[model samples]
Target: MIKDRQLYKLILSILTVIVVAMIGLQLVSSWTQPQAQSQLNLYESDLLLQASTWQETNDAEPGTSPLLENLWGDSDPVQQALKNYQKIKTSATLQSGPTDDPEKRAASEAFVNELDLRLGLLYARSGQVEDAIATWTPLAEAAPSPGNQRAVTAAILQGLWSDPPQLKPQAQQQLESQLKGWFRYQSLSQLYQLQQRQETLTTLRSQEHAAAEKALTRLAAVQVFPAIGGLTGVGILIFWLIQFAVKKRQSLPEAASTAPTIEPIEAQADQTPNTPQELAATVRWPVTTIWQVMVVWFAAFFCVSFVLPVVLYVAGAKPETFGARGQAYLALIQYSLLMGVGFSILYLSLKPFLSQPLKWLPLRWQGSWFSWGLSGYLAALPLVIVISVLNQKLLQNQGGGNPLLEIILNSHDRFSMGLLLFMVAVLAPLFEEILFRGFFLTSLTRYLPMWSAIGLSGLVFAIAHLNLSDILPLTVLGCMLGFVYTRSQNLLASMLLHGLWNSGSFIGLIILGSSVS
Candidate 1:
C-alpha cells in the first residue's frame, strides 16, 4: 500500500513539473514573438479594398446607374472602398496585369487611409468618438512622409473639431498636444511647413460646410444592431433562474419523498491503486474514452457553427445579426462564465467517477491560479484561431457563412467595425478553444505520449473545422495550444492567453484599418 501511494505521488509530481515547464516555455515564446500587427491590418484592409473593386467595375456602365446607386447608397464608404479594393486586386491579379508602380501603390495606400479616416469620422458622428480615435491613431503614426503625415493629422483634427463648437475646443487642445509630442524630434524646416499647412486646414475647419456635410451623409447611411444585446442578457438571466428554481424544487419535502437519489460523500480514506500496473491501467481507458467523447463534441461543434444555421433558417428563426464589438464583448463574458461553471462541475463530480473511464481528465487542480490560467491561455490561442478560420472557410464554401455575416461584410453599415471585431477575436476563439483545447487536448495527454497527444489534438482540431481553406491555419494554431496546455496543465492559462490573442488581433486590425487602403 505504501509503495503504491509513493508510486502515485511520484507520477503526479513528474506530470506537474512537466506541465509547469511547458507553460513557462509558451509564455517566453508569446512574449518574444508578438504578432506583426501592422502587417495584419494591411492584409485585412487590402482584402476589403479588393472586394470593393468588383462593385465599381460592375457599376461603370451608363445603364447600370441604379445598380451603382444601390451599391454606393446602401453600403458605407468604408465597405464600398474595401470591396472596391478587393475586386480590383483580385480581378487584376486574375487577369495577369502588371502590379502598379511604387507611386500608385503609395496613392492606393493613401486612398485606403483616407477612406478609413472618413469612416472613423462617420463613427464619431454616431457618438462613437473613442472608437474613431482608436481606428485613426495608427494612421497618424504611420503616415507615409511629412506631406502624408500632415494630411492625415489635419484630416483627423479637422474631423474632431468640425463636429460642434463644444466638441471643437476640447478636440483642438487634444490635437495640438498630440502634434507637439509627435513633431518634437523633426527638423525646424519640416515643422514650419507642416504647421503652415495645418493652420490652413484649421481655418477651413471653422466652416464645417463640406466635410461635416459629407460626414453626416455617410453617418446617415450607417446602421447599428437592434435589440440582440438586451435579449441575450435577458436569456442568460432566465436560464440561470430556471436552473436555481429547479434545484430549489428538488430540495422540497414533496420532491424528496418521491425520489430516492443517493447523496454522494467524499471518501475519508485514500484508495490507492493496488499496484503500479493497476495505476497505469486505471488511467489509460479514461483518457481514451474522454478523447472519443471530445471528438464527438467537436464534430457536433462544426455542425452547430456551420450546418445548424442553415437548419435554423429552414425552421424560420433568422440567424441573429449583431454588431462585431458587442458580439466580442458578450463572447468574452459568456466563455469565461461557461469555463468557470464547467470546471467547477467537473471538479465536484470527478471523485465519484474515479473508477469510471473518466478519471484521466483532471478537473481537480494542485497549482497556483496564475500558473493554471497562464497555461490555459497559452495552450488555447493557436487552436482557437486555427479551428475558427477553418470553420469559416467551410461555411463560406457551402454558402453557409451566416447570411447576416455576409450582409455585414458586404453591405455598407455602421456596424461593420463591430462585426469584424467579433468574428476575428471573440466568437471564433472562445468556441474553438473550449471544444478542443480545454477538453480534448488535456484528455488525450493522459494516455498518449506527450508529442502524440499534441499531434492528435491538432489533427482532430484541423479536421473538425471541415474546410480545406482553414486546414493550414487551424492545424498550426491547434498544435501550439496543445503544446502549451500539456506544458501548463491549467485551463485558466489557456483561456486568458487565447482571449488576449484574439482581442489583440481585433485591435491590431482596427489600427491597421485606419491606414490600409
Candidate 2:
C-alpha cells in the first residue's frame, strides 16, 4: 500500500513540476517584451509641446528666457522647432538594418515612415504646409501601405489646399504632386480593401464547407454507432476491472496495494487474461467484420461530410446567400454532431478491443473543482505568453519567421480578431494537445526515454503549427504538455491545462483591446 501510494505521489509531483515550469516560461516571456513605443512616446510629446510653443510666436528677436533665447536665438521659435523636427526627420529616414528577417526589416521601414508622417503632421500644423506635403510625398511612395498611404496623402492634400499662393513654384508643384498621388492612392486603397473582404469571405466559406463535411463523415464512418458503443465500452471496462478486483480479493489473503508474501491468484490470472489481440477474435466475426463495417461507415460519413460540400463549393454555392446567423448555426450543429460521433466511435472501436481494463477512463477527481480548473489555468497561462514571445523574438529575429503572414493575419479588425481567437485559443491548443500530449507522447514513452518522448513530441507540435516563426514557443508548450501528461498518466489533466492556456489567451486579447485605446 505504501509503495503504490509513493509511486502515485511521485507521478503527481512530476506533473506539478511540468505545470510550474510552463507557468515560469510564460512569466519570463511577458517580462521581456520591448517597450519601444512607450519609451519614445514621452519624448515625442515633449517635442510636440516645444513645437506648439515655438508656433505661438513668429518674432525674429530671441525671448527673454535664457533657455528659449539660446535655443531659438534671433530666429522664430516655431521655425527653430520645425528645424529640430526636420533634424529628427532626417535621422528617422528608412534604412535597412542588420536583420535577416524580412518581416522585421519591413516593420522597421514602416516605423520610419510613421515617424516621417508624424514630422509632416507637425510641419503642416505650424503653417509649413508645403514642407509637410513634400515630406509626406516620398513616404507615400516608399512604404505604400494602403491604409498609411491614404492617411498621409490625405494629410498632404489638406496641407496643399490650405497653403497660400505666395509659396514658391516648387512648393506649388509639390502640392500638384500630392493631388496626382491621390488618384493612384485612392484606387489602390479601394482595391486592397476589396481584396481583403473577398479573402475573408472565401475563408469563411471554406470553414463552413469543412465543418459540414466533417459532420456527415462522422455519421457514415461508424463501425459501430457512437451512443451505444461508448456506453457499452465503458460498461465492459468497468465489469472487467470489478472482476479482476474481486478475483484478486478471493484468492489473495491481503490487499493488492499491500506488499504480500505471495502473488495473488487473480493477478496471476489477469497476466494471461482471456483477451484476444485481433479484432476478429475480439468481436465474434463473420456477420460483422470490423474492418468492412468501419470502412463502409467511414465512407458514408466522408461522402456526406466532406465530398458533398466540396462539390457544392466547386459548383459555386454562395454561403452569404444563406445569411451569417444561419451559417453560424449550421456550423455549430455540424461540429457538435461530429464531436459526438467521434467520441462514440472512439469509445467503441479502440476501448473494446484493447486488453487493458477501462479503469483508466474514469474521471478521477484531483483537487477542489476551483483548484483543478483555475489553478491549472493559472499554471498554463505563462506557457502561452512564453511561446508567443519566443516565436516573435528568437525565430523572428533570425529572419526565419513569417512576419508578413503575421502582419496580414494580425490586422486588428473584427475578422482578424475572430480568427486569431479561434486559432490561438481554440484550434491550436485542442488539436495540438491531442497530437503531442495524448498521441505522440503516449507512443514515444512506450519505446524511448521519458525526456526524449517529451522533447520529440514538443518539436513535432511546434512544426505542425506551420511557421518557422512559431517554432520556439509551440515547441516549448508541446514539451510542457507532453511532460505533464506523461508524468500524470492523466490525459484529462493535460487537456484541462491546455484548455486553460487557451482561455488565458482569450482573456489576454480582451485586455489588449482595452489597453489599445
Candidate no. 2 TM-score: 0.41
Write one digit per residue (lDDT tens) for candidate 2, span 1-517. Answer: 9999678567655654654454345434433322222223223333323332332233335344453343325665445545655654444342344768898677667656655655665575567767767776776565446445444454444434343412222333333344221122222233334336667444444443343333223222221233333455356446545876978743112112222132224333213212111101122122222333233333333434565467658988754464434344444444444445544553454454344423323124553333333333443345545555554444323223322222222244555445445554555455445544544454343344456657887876665433444566767766766645543445566666677666543543333222211
Candidate 1, residue 464: the lDDT equals 52
lDDT of each: 0.43, 0.44
RMSD (CA, Å), each prediction = 20.7, 20.0
List clash counts for every candidate, in order: 40, 12
TM-score of each: 0.38, 0.41
Q: Least lDDT summed over 10 consecutive residues: which range in candidate 2?
A: 273-282
State the lDDT at 158 in candidate 2: 41
Tens digits of per-residue lDDT for model 1 on 366-467?
Answer: 555355444444334434544554554443322111122323333334465565556546555555565566556544444555566567878767655443
